[model samples]
Target: MKKKIILIAVFVIAVAASVYLYAMYKPHRDITAETADFTVSVKQLQEEYAKNDTMFNKKYMDKTIEVKGVVSTIDDAENGIVIDEKLSVTFNDSTKKEIAVGKSIKIKGRLLTYDDILEEFKMDQASVIK
Candidate 1:
C-alpha cells in the first residue's frame, strides 16, 4: 500500500539522521592525540570570553584550544591546572607534568566552560603542549 510505503520511508530517513548525529557528537576515539582548533594566550582569551561569554562558548565549546600562559597553580585538588588564575585546563587522569608556578606553558584540551562567578574559563580532557 502507498501509505505503508510512505511510513517505511519516513522511518528509514529518521534512522539515518539519528546515526549521523550520533557519529558527529561522539567523543574523539583518540582524545589525547587530538589536535587543537585554536591557539591563544591566557590574557587575550580570557578577555574575549569575558566580554562575550555566550558567543565565545558557542565558538570554543567541545573544540580543542591551546592556551599559553604562566602557571598560576596546579590543582591536584581538582582535575587540571589553572593558568594565570583565569583559564583552567584538565588533562586525562594519567597525564602528569612537573610544571612550577610562574613557568610559561601551553596546554591543549577541549574547552569546557567559562564561570562568571569564578571569573575563570575551564577546559577538560587536555594535554600539555610541548
Candidate 2:
C-alpha cells in the first residue's frame, strides 16, 4: 500500500509540473493577426461608454477592437497616440510611421480600460491600419 501511494503521488507531482511549464512557455498572442471583435469610431465608443459605463465595459474590456478617429496628440514617450482627445492607443511595434496630428487613422488593439479621471479610453498592442 505504501509503495502504491508513493507512485501515485509522484505521478501527480510530475503532471502538475508539466502543466505549469507548458502554461508558462506558451507563445504570446499575435494581436496584429487577430480579427477585431468590434470596429467603431472613437466618438461612438466614447458615447457608448458614457451612456452606460458598466455595460460598455463588459462589452469591450480586454477585447480586440479597431477604432477610427483623427489624431489629436502623439506621445513618443508612451509610444502611442490620442485619438480625438478621448482614446489613447499604445503600439506594440515602434516602427510605424507617417502619423500626423489632424490626420484620420484607424488602429487595431485590445481595449484595456476606460480612465474615468482622464475621461479617456486606453488600448494597447495596437497597430495602425491606415
Candidate 3:
C-alpha cells in the first residue's frame, strides 16, 4: 500500500512538472517571418492611421505578428517606438534595445487590440528583431 501511494504521488508530480514546463516553453501560435506582407511604405501606414484602422490589427489581432519597417523615431521619454509613419508602438526595455532610428528591421510579437476615441483600432506588444 505504501509503495503504491508513493508511486502515485511521483506520477502526479511528474505530470504537474511536465504541464508547467510545456506552459512555460510553449511557442506562441501565429508567428510568421513574413516580410513581403509588411513592405508597405511609411506614407501608406500613415494613411491607414488617418483612417483610424490599421492593417496590423486587421490581420494579426490576438496573435503573434511579424513586420518589417523603418524605425522613424525612438521616444525614450515615453518608452515607445514610432515606425513606418504614424504607428506608435510601446515595448519593454529589452525590445527597445534592439531598435534604432533609421534602421530597417523586423518586429515579431503578440498583437493586442485596442479601441479608443483617438484611434479606432491599434496593435501593441511588438518585439524587435535583434
Local distance difference test scores for all models: 0.80, 0.91, 0.61
Candidates sorted on TM-score, descending:
2, 1, 3
Best-matching candidate per lDDT? 2
Candidate 3 structure lDDT = 0.61
Comparing 1 and 3 on lDDT, the stronger one: 1
Best by TM-score: 2
In order of appearance, the predictions have TM-scores of 0.72, 0.88, 0.47
**Clash pairs, model 1 backbone:** none
TM-score of 3: 0.47
Error of 3 at 77 (Å): 2.7
Please, what are the lDDT tens digits per residue for candidate 3 over residues 1-130? 9999999999999999999999999985533343323444445544664575666457545655455678878888877776764456666444666677998877665546544554422445556665
For candidate 2, write residues 1-130 as lDDT tens digits. 9999999999999999999999999998888999999999988998898899899989999899999899999999989999999999999978347799998898899999989899999999999895
Q: After superposition, how far is residue 31 of candidate 2 from its true place, in Å?
A: 1.3
Tell me the spans in candidate 2 whose CA falls farther than 4 Å from its real position.
none
Q: Tens digits of per-residue lDDT for model 1 on 1-130? A: 9999999999999999999999999976555687778888877777777798778778888887788899888778676778899887776874445677898888788877878789888888777767
